[model samples]
Target: MASYHRVLEVFDRSVQDKTLECAYDLDPWDILIDDERWTGKIRLFGFVDIFFLICYSGEERFEKGIIIYKDNDSVRIILERARKNTTEYVVNRDALENEEIPKSYFSFEDDKGGLNYQILGLGHPIGLSTNYDPGSLKQYKIKIRRSDDLVTRKRMQRGLKQHTLIDLMLDVVRLGIITSAELISKVVTMTVAGSATDDLARKYLQVLSGGQPGTPGLSRDRM
Candidate 1:
């Protein structure tokens, strides 16, 4: 398991100016780790450290989903991950059939604790064909609102059980954890480990590419 102390230590050394702009207090660390409500929630996700409780202030302004990672050159990168996965949205034709869509929240739970991320923005509808049920009718993915939203649909079948790979990729991009250009480069280019590649950079890339790293790969237990 990756210790919180070790993560904070890395964060302390990585910051160029030793200051992270946040909506919290002058010392965001104190409020984040010291407070019981926020303790253990802030953790290493993918190649970056996700401060779930803190709203980050970046090039834009205050944004939700703050992630701290390393740049391609191994510099500390801090940015906000957005709630909506993509801007391209398709209108739902089945308005009468669809129920009220509540907000989406991803809960990361493990032995230590749980962090609930309240997904921002009104969700945009997109279709992903599934292998389990392959057909024209299965081409369109079920709407993902709240977990309960699926309870009433399709004879009260299962709801959104997991986040898709595309969803995770968009998350990092939207949050500014990794830029589109950076993402593209990582995907196309072959990465060599050790002195040749940035470990943190590789971790985020690995995560977006749907591979789990040895250390703190979005697993709460590892965190």
Candidate 2:
């Protein structure tokens, strides 16, 4: 259990800029910690310190993501541990406001080679929503209506697409078709055309290629 105060102090020093230090102001955002769901705003008093570290030494480092100071006398810190300068994190499920759908819903064989569209309802009739077995399919659906503002609609669309891609990657890993490292590499290749996964894909690529100084690596606790 790392102390929140220590984490904050180290983070403040890392930023160096006086204007970038944490002020402890609560700014709300939905975040996922490991497998648990948490809803809260960040406590950034000034500049948004979206990234920080709890510990770092000799090529081993633990990066902090969302720090939720719950009123229940407990603090939830999303951590990503990397050893020997590797780009991988220890727990890897960090997507804000996104729910994890069970991997069982995606059935695949080692030789299957790619996603099964029939099972995923990829070619289903346009007007009809695809339905999976009850209790088998669990995902967060972003309902966008015509009445939604432009920004809201765009955000929902981005979220929905990102959710779908994450599910696909998870399914690939779950089926043993590819290791998580391979999946990340594949995603980077696939996203060269550009998509919601571009930022993350690029990060993984940097890690795989031996990260440059000052570049952030992928966290196990991030999506």
Candidate 3:
């Protein structure tokens, strides 16, 4: 067995200000072993979602969270996680640049015939650029897999329904159909009336309602 180590560096910027607010260096994370493959699902912010399945035969390393795939004789199968109701296969740059690599290795099939495991990637605070220069800085990513079954699929569907409800509520507020204060009050009241454990949700509502004082109305223009 070949031992591999990898590292990843992440840069986080505020979408509102477009300013680099934080940076992180994560080290000694997970490694992809030879002949082992995995698949998994990701639920973010209760709305953003992705379902993926992958199979690979390779040895890779992470050093301080920077990504480095050491073995040239590696093959990977990747299913692009779906977002906004779109999904596809993901091709690694290495596979694209190397003529020896065949595109079929990364192909994705919708049929549930193969291994269905969850591969959970390490989560960092930054979004990486697809066109990044690897020579100047190394990039690292992680994947986690779980067995895909009817139960997990149903859970993901439920999450999507809830996310849609929340989005509709926010849209109403954005369109000025309802005041931010009204929305905040409703959320706070419902939360307080039901489960008091969701302090984060309450705080988020407060932030939305307590915008800069004297602002005329809730407008997506300001967001």
Number of the top lDDT candidate: 2
**TM of each candidate vs. truth:** 0.20, 0.19, 0.20
Better of 1 and 2 by TM-score: 1
Local accuracy of candidate 1 as per-residue lDDT tens digits, 153-194: 221111112234364456557667668878766544533323
Q: How does model 2 score by TM-score? A: 0.19
What's the number of clashes in each of the models?
A: 3, 6, 34
Indicate whether candidate 2 or candidate 3 has the larger lDDT: 2
Q: For model 2, how does the per-residue alpha-carbon lDDT over 143-216 read when each residue is reduced to its tens digit? A: 11221245643332222221345755765676466799888878787656534333432221111212345433
Model 3 TM = 0.20
Where is model 2 poorest over a 10-residue stretch in terms of lDDT? 119-128
The candidates, ranked best first by lDDT, are 2, 1, 3
Native-referenced Cα lDDT, model 3: 0.26
Model 3, poorest ten-residue lDDT window? Answer: 77-86
Error of 2 at 159 (Å): 5.0
* lDDT of model 2 at position 21: 25
Clashing pairs in 1: 80-175, 81-175, 82-175
Model 2, residue 40: C-alpha shift (Å):
4.0
Which ranges of candidate 1 are over 4 A from the true structure?
1-7, 10-23, 26-48, 52-183, 189-198, 201-223
Q: How well does candidate 1 score on lDDT at residue 59?
A: 30
